[model samples]
Target: MRHWIWVVAAFVAITPFTVNAAGAEPVGSAGALISGKSPDGLGTWTVRYQHFDGNSPVAAVINDRIDDAANHEVQHATWNGSTRRPWTFDATGTINVRPTTVSEIFVGQYNTDEPNMPMQSLGSVVCDSRSGTVITWDNLFQDKTSGLTRLSAEVEARLAPAASSNELRDWRRSGQFAPIDVNFKHWVATPQGIELHFPPLQFGRGLKIVTVPWASMSDQITPEFVAITE
Candidate 1:
């Protein structure tokens, strides 16, 4: 974790929002119907995000995703008082791939006053370096159907060792590798391949990563994506 990404903040007005296709990130609790309050005032949260050095739209999108991810504590935490339970949050991301352009990914986790509800959130976004448009799985491969089919097969194979439970196996087939936008939400483009981030709570225990290598899917991957990753 870089020092810049370790900085804490609160309700900062400049935080960027997510793109339409990227979808709303899952929050800790949303302060949802869950009643709660901190005996102490809402303690300040430790929020940190990956700082992009560039000013391009790609940078903007990544920063926004990080900002949104880090706020899960303040926006969704639960307790029973005027203020939500005291929670601390931290997030980090990186420009993992820059084939024809740049792409980024971010993940966050928080510790809270509530015992049962430990917080964990993961988010990732990839954008066109020039246009700034949110890029999806369909965009990474030239032939959407074949691309996904191949990627799906490859991803499942790689995750075989980690898919220890039936729940994980089902999600791997239906959700994680599904063409659904949210399914691939937590991912990054990498020169090595498309690296996935699966938070333990949802997938299993510790974080699990399964990379679909470019060499295995080169024939169908978008040329732009293969240029740098392969």
Candidate 2:
């Protein structure tokens, strides 16, 4: 990770508690909305980053990681030079699952410009708001081996209905698709299901969400996971 050195000040905001759906916890704080525009002579670039709690020590862990990656892309663009001018980077965070039930699921939606197409990356975390600690991915599954296998299969199946079956077939055989790993390293848990993202051209789809519903995976998920998603 590139060590971050500040050239621009980021705007930070802490949202006060607000009403939420019945049985759900109050909507917790929103992240500091940090944005920066390149100074003169660097060419034109802008960055939008959020979902970082400037007040919490642990929040920096996730925030800095994403920031470094985003900055790397910004630097890459300046060096490589995209066909399109005014390169951009956005790393916005969302609380996919509210902090109502002792836990909250947050996902970083990162986008950066490429020569021909925009690139996407994901970072997801499930935090125990009560404990102020992150809930590791492995802890969610009962039988880790089988659960992961099932999850990987579900992800593959999600892309089956897309128009680019030929490309999908080749992708399945490629190194990126094989040896499927459901590390939960890149996922967002919603009320309806778990959404895993894949970037454009992967399946000839602009962007893809490989959603696996909570019901289908009930057998594999731990009781704690059940509670969180419920």
TM-score per candidate, chains pooled: 0.62, 0.60
lDDT, candidate 2, 60-152, per-residue tens? 554544455445445443444333345455554444434422222322223334344455544455554433345554676787777777777
lDDT of each: 0.54, 0.51
Model 1 misplacement above 4 A: 1-10, 13-43, 55-84, 97-99, 143-145, 162-177, 223-228
C-alpha lDDT of residue 2 in model 1: 11
Score candidate 1 by lDDT. Answer: 0.54
Q: What value does the lDDT take at residue 146 in candidate 2?
A: 73
Per-residue lDDT tens digits for candidate 1, residues 1-230, read 11122222333443333423453233210110111222354533333334444566665665554455444333433221124445555544444436344454555566666665455666666656555556677777788877777876776777767556786667765566675555555777666777877776545567777887778878886766555454
